[model samples]
Target: MSSSHPTPQPWYKQFWPWFLIGLLLSSIAVSTSFAVLSIRSFDGMVQEDYYEHGKAINMVLAKQQQAADLNLGATLRIDPLTSDAVLDLTGDDRPERLVLKLIFPTEADRDHELRLEHVRDGRYLGQAPDNLRYRWYLQLQPDQETPTWRLVGEGRFPDEGEFALTPGRAADS
Candidate 1:
């Protein structure tokens, strides 16, 4: 007597093999999407001239020390309606024009510099864009190509609209 045996199904038709293959393919697809995203998005967090920036740290500290030596303090106020900015700077020597630097914490493109003309004794006037509604790193400097001193402050803008700056606050430590 002769006995007949049935043939087994191929691996492609097996459940475990297809399940494993599906998992591998899914992983590959996910990794490809993440790679594309990283390639397309440019986060502006890295500086090209990191060495130069490091070298400038000493100069910034010197400027801060100069501001402290001058005993500088200021109160900055902004008008919500007219988008006007006024600063009352207290120090021994005041400049004819002041440079107000508004630096956004995360977005470099949102940084702004406004030149405030000296209106009168200790009063400086400038116009700010009405769209500044976020927090900023503020720096007050003489309107020069290279500022010798700077009064640094930080505050959430438009909501409070008024802030004080002093050389004692670590000068943007």
Candidate 2:
């Protein structure tokens, strides 16, 4: 007597084969996502002339030294209500125009420069844009010849406290 046997299903139809395929597909999906994200988000530093920039540091320091020699001091006040910035300067020479620089660290797009008007003797006033809330690197410079003096400081936006500016450095209130 001869016995008849049933044929087994193909590997493609089997559950274990499909499960293995699913795991491989999932791994590929995750790796592709990571690669896309890595390509999209990159640090913004792309300057190739890093050496030249480093060499220019000396010139910047020299300008600071000029400020130090001039005995420049300024008191900065920011109004919280209107966001208006006022600078009171004390030094030998009074500049006709003052250049105010507001630098937002890590965000170059937000950096601003305002030419302050001389309100009176030893007083400068400028209408800074309102609703600013961030840390800033403040640079107050006189509109003068090259190698002129400047005062540097750091402060939070909408600052109500008083800040004293020293040449090449910042002083806390």
Candidate 3:
């Protein structure tokens, strides 16, 4: 009897089929890698006590109003070389020790607070971060509770200049 032809091979064994499968797999691998990278680098900083903050909004506004009533303001200067922060107060009266809070917009760990010492009349001095840049929310207060005012501004380091901090009104927004 005549020899029978070999049975046709399955489609999976063919070169084109394997090549297409590999191409799809490679695309999936690339997309998955990008997704992982984005997740790891995301800076999603949210306040843990958002509810409390929301509840205390009225009090915060009241404090702002208090600052307005007192007509308090200041001029802030940071020396890049010495990392020294100076505040010149312009108001009716000054507190014994003014609290300077440098709050990072997105990173809570980068937030810093300095209890500025009153060097002279309407002048306060404290140590600031050496390498501070980008936008920052500044809160100048005497204590943790009431009598607080917020000043939002951007810090352009390595440049010798001064920034204004007026109470009851945000510098940037």
The most accurate candidate by lDDT is: 1
lDDT of 2 at 69: 85
Model 3 poorest 10 in a row by lDDT: 149-158
- Per-prediction TM-score, please? 0.89, 0.82, 0.78
TM-score-best of 1 and 3:
1
Which regions of candidate 1 deviate over 4 angstroms? 168-173
By lDDT rank, best first, the candidates go 1, 2, 3
RMSD values, in order shown = 2.3, 2.7, 3.2
RMSD of 3: 3.2
Better of 1 and 2 by lDDT: 1
lDDT of 1 at 17: 92
Q: Clash pairs of candidate 2?
A: none
Candidate 2 residue-wise lDDT, 1-173, digit = tens: 98989899999989999999999999999999999998898666755688998998787777678778877788888898987888998887678789888888887778988878888988998888777787888888877666377788888866688877778666556
Candidate 1 residue-wise lDDT, 73-157, digit = tens = 8888888778799999998869999999888888888999999999899999999888678678888989988888988888676
Of the two candidates 1 and 2, the one with more favorable TM-score, higher being better, is: 1
Q: What is the C-alpha lDDT of each candidate?
A: 0.84, 0.81, 0.77
Q: How accurate is candidate 3 locally (lDDT)?
A: 0.77
How many clashing pairs per prediction, in order?
0, 0, 0
